[model samples]
Target: MILWLTVVQIIVAVAAGAFCLVAGLVGRRPSDFSVGALALVELLLVVQVVVAIVAPLAGNPPTGDLLEFWVYLVSAVLLPIGAVLWALMERSRWSTVILGVAALAIGVMLWRMQVIWTIQVA
Candidate 1:
């Protein structure tokens, strides 16, 4: 995995999370900017998935458990979409809160993924 890419993912995820949280706090429903930011996060996650697939094939596999890593990656990809769907259906400030929580989850997951990628194989 590219180190800087993971760093970027972490930063974007945190930013998206913060965006959602603040929107929710302000009693705003899911707006275009928030949704766009969520979409941007999802796009980055797609890039991550592609990287995860290609890097290993190119002999840059994660040093930790591959299955665990893939599971995290898959969850990372799905989380924001789920949150968006839930927000759309609910259409409330709480929905924005859910999105915020999901984004934070993605950020934590990315951090864990970075740790997994950098771990030394014993």
Candidate 2:
């Protein structure tokens, strides 16, 4: 995984998580901004996928089991999609909570991706 992009994902995830926590307490519903966050996550995920596909072509190459990489990769790609679905279901503060979970989950997956890369490199 690209370190810079992963860093971005971590930061965004943390922000989204914090947003959710704060929103849940205020008794306010999630807004379009929540969906916006999910959208951003999806955009970043797309970038990562592009990186994954192009890295090998560029000769930088993935440093792990291709199948496992793909598994995590697909999950990473799906998180935002799930978030969108969750948000659709939850129009209230609960949606933010769901988004928070999605963000945290994506961040964890990103960390896992790094770990996988390190293991493969070793």
Candidate 3:
């Protein structure tokens, strides 16, 4: 795993979470700003996934279980898309809540990815 890239992903995810939370708290439905921010986050995650895959092929496999890491990566990539879909359908303040929760979940998932990347096996 590329350490700096992972750090960037974590920061972006957390920032997206904060943005969503504040929007939700203000009783705002999901807006272009929120969706755009999430899309950017998703884009970064896709880049991370590419790096994760290629780095291993280039002989830099993570220290942790590859399966676990892949699972986290895939889930992290899917989350924002799902949240955006749900928010578009719901079209209410609750939709913003969904986005907020999704953002936070992505943040946690990214952090977990970092843990998985660095974990040592006995």
Candidate 4:
């Protein structure tokens, strides 16, 4: 993955976390605003998926535990999609909790990506 792209994702994740925290505190559900924020992070993740696929094709296959990397990537992307769906169905503060979970998952995924990258480099 491109380093700058990871940085951008970090920023997006942080913002999403803040928004989710506020939404949780205020007892809110997903709206255009919350969904829009998640969309920004999702966009970054899509770019990451593209780059990750291309990198391996360009002779940069991951040297880390390959299964771990793939699992983290797939799991991270799925969380937000699930959150969106759950939020739509719940229509309550629980929806914000779903977003909070997504935000937290993103942060964990970011760290896991770094670990996988470092393992490859080492």
Top of the candidates by lDDT? 1
lDDT of 3 by residue, 1-122 (tens): 88788788778878888888888888999899888888999999889888997997998778888888899889889999999999898888778877878878888888888877777651
Number of the top-ranking candidate, with TM-score as the measure: 1
Better of 1 and 4 by lDDT: 1
- Per-residue lDDT tens digits for candidate 1, residues 1-122, read 88899889889888989999999989999987777778889999999999998998998878888888889999989999998998888899988988888988999999888889878562
Clash count per candidate: 0, 0, 0, 0
Poorest stretch of ten by lDDT in candidate 3: 113-122
For candidate 4, lDDT tens digit of each residue in 6-73? 77788788789788768877988778888777777787788888888898788867767867877888
Q: Which should have the higher lDDT, number 2 or number 3?
A: 3
Q: Give model 3's TM-score versus the native structure.
A: 0.93
User: Of 1 and 3, which scores higher on TM-score?
Assistant: 1
lDDT of 2: 0.77
lDDT of 2 by residue, 6-120 (tens): 8998788778767765775676577777677777877888888888888778776667777787799799788778877877876777777777788778888878886776567
Worst 10 residues of 1 by lDDT: 113-122
